[model samples]
Target: MLRRIEMRFLRPYLQEELKSVKMKSQIKFQIGKSGVTEGVIQSLNNAFRTRKTVRISLLQSSGRDRTKMKEIANELGDKLAGNFKHTIVGFTIIMKKTGARKPENKR
Candidate 1:
């Protein structure tokens, strides 16, 4: 009886988690030696306009280290300065667009 009750309550939560996993749509972008240039950032911003999630893949020929990749992710987040946030997944960087944040005053 206790097992049945637990399962009933847990089912919806498990299903909801699975639904979220399935809903995560990822767009892929490859970073080159230009190293996150204005065009790169603009493209990323454009992708965020349409999709909530993006993946940034670093290439081997670029000669960047893993730690550097992480730093790049942080830099991108700062440059974006809006709804964008980043995470490093294996060899790829994953960025997600969340609720909009207030723009920082440049002046």
Candidate 2:
């Protein structure tokens, strides 16, 4: 009886957590020796149409330099159609589409 009551209270919370996890759709891309090419940008744009997050892995051939990775991330962010922000973790770049572009201020 006690176990059943405990489960009933926990069930709703567990379901909500699971739903949140499932809702985050992600896609992965890799940068090879060719680096960031038009094909890559096109594919990433397509992926973003359906997914909210993109995980980009920098292959060894793509160079492991942290500064290079940041540059690539910035380039990708700029080329992408919508507003995006990226975070670099080791050789991986996690880019998420931030809805609505912020208006640029002109002096």
Which candidate tops TM-score? 2
Model 1 lDDT, residue 107, Cα: 88
Q: Please, what are the lDDT tens digits per residue for candidate 2 over residues 36-79? A: 99999999999989887778889999988888998999999999
- Model 2: how far residue 97 lies from native, Å: 0.1
Global fold similarity of model 1 (TM-score): 0.66
Candidate 1 deviant stretches above 4 angstroms: 1-26, 100-107
Worst 10 residues of 2 by lDDT: 17-26
- lDDT score at residue 48, model 1, on the 0-100 scale: 80
Q: Write the per-residue lDDT of candidate 1 for residues 1-107, one digit (tens) a residue.
A: 53344335545865454346335655778887778788888988888888777878888865568788878898889888475666554456778777856799998
> Where is the poorest 10-residue window by lDDT in model 1?
14-23
lDDT of 2 at 63: 85
List of clashing residue pairs for candidate 2: none
Best by lDDT: 2
Residue ranges of candidate 2 with Cα displaced over 4 Å: 1-26, 101-107
Error of 2 at 106 (Å): 28
Residue-level error in angstroms, candidate 1, position 99 = 1.0
